[model samples]
Every structure is written in C-alpha cells, then in structure tokens.
Target: MDVVVGRVAKAHGIRGELAVDVRTDSPEARFALGSVLAAKLRDGTSRDLTVAAARYHSGRLLVRFEEVLTRDVAELLRGTLLLGSTDALPPTDDPDEFYDHQLEGLAAELADGTRIGTVKEIVHGPGGELLVLVREDGSEALVPFVRQIVPTVDVAGGRVVVDPPEGLLDAD
Candidate 1:
C-alpha cells in the first residue's frame, strides 16, 4: 500500500526547491535526505524522486529532489502527491497510536454494539484529526478522533467504539 506523505504546494525561489504540504506525522523521516518517494503526478503517471536536500522554512517543508534542478521543473511538480510504501513504515510503539490506514474501513459502532457506520477515512487538519464515517443512511459524520469521543479502537477485532455526544451524529 502506498500512503501519501506530502503534496507539492508550489515551486520555491529560482532553485528546484519545492514547498510541500506534509501529510505524514513523521515528516523528518519521510522527507529525509536520500529518501526516495513516489511522485504521483497530475497526469496519472508516477515517478521516483530522490531527496537531495530538505529543510524547514517558516513552518513549511522545502525539498529539493535529485531529478529536479530548475524552478521550471519544480513548478511542473506542483500538486504532485508524494507517496511512501506502507511496508517501509515502522509500526507504532504506542498502544494508543495508529496509522490512518488502520482505522479506515473498520466498523464503527456504539458501546452497546449497535452498528452505525464504517470509517471512510481520517481527516487531518489544523484543528485535529477527524474520523470521517459513512453513516447507515449514506450521509457522512465527522467525529473528533479524541480519546473522549472515540474511547475504544479494536484493530484486531475490526471495529471502533464511538461514544458521540448528542447531536453529533444527527443528520442535518
């Protein structure tokens, strides 16, 4: 499985440096020097890009790939999705921690085991992580992925126990 680690936001300066919007929690490891990432371009083709240099500037990650050496080349890479193989990822040591892929497609239910939905995906934003659920009615619900709301996650059992507050799962 290929997981998105970053997206090319734009070309930076006159060099081949690219400003990237990080999607992975471990950006340092994912964008480290010598790391090779699969770039899924807008044209549906994929290419391997080797990280030549990387740096943090003003809270954004700037990366220069070995295959790119000019601003024009970097500009062409804008909006490219940088992917890393899931097999290269190390398992999380913390019991409470989980990869987005692990939570997706799991059965979402209440504490009483009443099935409500299936986890569609995990949305990571500035506020926090949200559990996007595809409800029984085909509508979607965004549940905050905090310990208070999602009290239980049984990856092996293939389910998540959601303890949502009133009106949280209500249809508009």
Candidate 2:
C-alpha cells in the first residue's frame, strides 16, 4: 500500500536540505516535519528516513532528512521516491476527488458498458495527470484524468466510467 508522494528534485543547500518535487496533491501532510517515510533508491535499495525538517521556499517544498546529513548525500537522493501508506494520509474531503492509488487497477469501461481496459498507472505531466489504460491486446491508451473524460470513479465498486470524446482512443 505504499504510494509515492514525492521525488527528490535536488540538493537544496549545503546543510543536507533537499528540494522535492511533490507528486501527491497533499504535500503538506505527506512531507510534514517529523514524518517518517519509506523510500526506494534508484539502485533498487530501500531505506526508512525521518523528516527532520520541512519548509517552503518560493512555493517549492524543501526537506531535510535526519539520516542525510550532508549535501553530497542529499544530492545522491535525486530521483528517489518518497513513499507513504494510504491509511496514514488524510481522507479526501472532496467527494469527486480520488487519490491516484484508488484509481490504479480499477476496471475502465465506456458509458455503454464496453470493456475497454483497466487502469495500469497514472502519468503526471505538465499538462495534467493521465490515466494509462492497457487493453486486452496489450496496447495502451492515455486518457485525460478530467471530469469530462472520466466522469465516474467507483472505488468501492472497483470500476471507472470513461466518456472519451472523438479521436481520444485513436493511436497516433
């Protein structure tokens, strides 16, 4: 149930602080001071780190881990993924909103109940987040994660209803 909440952007300062590119919508809660996080490094190793300090600088999140006490160590953490469990995160107050973890693996069907595929992963990009759908033929489709495109998300029922517009599902 470990979900990636952030990625190490780069070393912030000489004092082991790290600039983080937050992936989760709730960065304040996910990267709070004194919060412990589990991480998987690029080399396939794992470590548990405690958030020694966290601050915002010009709207960017800066964090310092107690274990990473030097700028060199922090620099090595670039591209590292910070993990948090879903149970520890605050519940979503907006009923229409759903976390990325909740959408992964859900069956995606059309409005007329056509079984298109299942959600493989969520791709976060500059434009917005997209739902990666894998079909039975093993082809993939990137569906925009918007209310107009993805109207319904039934997490409890394990299904997502998509309303794709013309040419949306076409392969380019």
Candidate 3:
C-alpha cells in the first residue's frame, strides 16, 4: 500500500533542490533525512530515492535527493510522485483521527442508515479537509470533513454516518 507523500512541483535551485507539493499530513516523518521514497515518474517508471536533505522555504517544502545532484536532473523529477508505504506509518491513537486511506472507499450513509454514496477521496485544502463522495446517482459531492456533518466513522464496519445539512447532497 504505497501512499503518496508528495509530488515534485519544480526545481527550486541550481543545487538540485526540488520544490515539493506535500500530500501527507506527517511530512516531517515522511521527508526526514535519509528516508527512502519511491519516485513514481509521469512516464510510468519508478525509482528509489534517498533523501539527502529537506527544508522549508517560503512555506514550500524543498527536498534534495541523493540521486539528483543537478538542477536539470531535478527538473526531470517535476510531477513525480513520492510514495511511502503504509506499513511504515503507525496507527493513529486519537479516536477522532484517521488516515485519508481509511476513510476513502467507505460507504457513506445518512444517520437513518440510508446509503447515499461512497467516499471517493479526502481533499486537503488550505481551508480544511473535505470528503469527496461519489453519490449514488454518479454525481460528486464535497462534504466538509467536520464533526458536525460527519458524526460517525466505523472503520471496521466499512461505513460512515453523515448528518449533512439540507441541500448538502443535492446535485448542482
């Protein structure tokens, strides 16, 4: 279960540093020094890369890979997805906390137990996280991943109880 930790946004400098668009919540652990990440390139090839160094610059994550020593080589890595295994991640201890993978694919249902849709993915934005749902009608719905609307998450049961407000699920 390889999860995307980040994507190479662009080459940051002449020293092969890459500006990365982080996807994971635990970027510190995922992009730690000496960490090995699988870089899935846009062309469908994958390569193992060792983290030489990582830093934050102007609110963006900058990373240098041991294999990428030139700016040209780093530029080639643009849009490459950096993957980390789920096996390396520890389970969350907080009852309210869950990894995005855990919520994705879960059945979404109303409080009354009427199934409405399936969770497509979790979108992390500057405002907040949103649950992208594939509704029964094949339309998509964005539900704010907040406690007020999503009251129950049964990971073992493979379902989530949604208490969406009026028109929240209505198709546009």
Candidate 4:
C-alpha cells in the first residue's frame, strides 16, 4: 500500500532538488538512494520516481529524483505528495505507534455504537495527534488523542472508537 511520507515544500536552490516537509519518524532514514517513490502531482496523476539522492538540510528533507533536473521541473512538483510502499518502511520501534496511512479513512464510533464520523486526517501538534473527523454532513471535529477519549483504535476493522468527555464533540 502506498503511504504518504512527505510533501514537496519548495525548490531548493537553482537545482532540481526539492525541499520536502517530512512527516515521518526518521526523515533521513525513510528516503534512501534507489528507493522508488510515487509522486501525486497537482494534475491528479501519479508518477513513479526513483530517488537519486535524499539528505537532510536546514530542518527539511532534500530530495533529488533521477529525471528531475531543473528548478522549473522541481517547481512543478511543489505541493506534490511523496508516497512510498509500506513494505519498504522499517517497522516501528514504538509499540503504541500507528502510521498516518493506517488512520486515514477509518470509521470513527463510540463504544455504544454511535457512529461519529470518518477520519479525514491526523494533525500532529504540540500535545499529540489530533484526529480530524468529518461527519456525513461535512462538519468536522477535532478529538484529542487522549486515552480517556480515544480508547480504542482498530486498524484491522478500519475503525477508531472514542469515548469523548462531556462537551467534547459538542463543541463547534
């Protein structure tokens, strides 16, 4: 399965190298030479790109593709999503860890069978990951990643059951 690892932030220097806003545990460790990446371009097409070189510079992942060779080419790739196969990723050392890819589109519910919403996205912040849940009507809710709230996460069943406190989901 393709897992989103990063996004092409902007063009680095005059070269075709891209500065990626990494969203992984070890950014430098994820994108290695010869690694194949699927880039989701702005035109809604996916391109298979071979990693020529990947390194860390100025708190960002500097990535160069085999065919991308100029600022113009790299600029076109800006906002493009860098995706890699889950098999290529190293196993997580943390037991409680969950990948962002696994959380996307999962059903959100309560233990009592109250269907809350579907996970639209996971937002990483100072506290932790905030689950962005989108209801059927297109309204969104931000649920804290606390155990008291999100008591269960069933990736296999594609669901995350939450037990939100009073006024939690009640908030606009």
Best by lDDT: 1
Model 2 ranges off by over 4 Å: 56-60, 123-128
The models' CA-based lDDT, in order, is 0.93, 0.89, 0.92, 0.84
Ordered by TM-score, highest first, the candidates read: 3, 1, 2, 4
- Please, what are the lDDT tens digits per residue for candidate 1 over residues 1-172? 9888899999999989999998777788889899999999999999999999999999889999999999999999999999998788789999999987788899999999999999998877789999999999999999999999999999999999999999999889
Question: Which residue pairs clash within candidate 3?
Answer: none
lDDT (Cα, tens digit) per residue for candidate 2, span 1-172: 8998888989988999999877786777888888889988999999999998899897678999999999999989999999998989768898998888898899999999898999987877769899999976789999999999999999999999999999998777
RMSD to the native, candidate 3? 1.5
| Number of the top TM-score candidate | 3
Give the per-residue Cα lDDT of candidate 4 at 10.
93
Which candidate would rank higher by lDDT, 1 or 3? 1
**Deviation from native of the Cα of residue 110 in model 3, angstroms:** 1.5
RMSD of 1: 1.9
Model 3, runs deviating above 4 Å: none
- Per lDDT, what order, best first? 1, 3, 2, 4
lDDT of 4 by residue, 11-71 (tens): 9988799998876554565687887789999899999888899887865679999979999
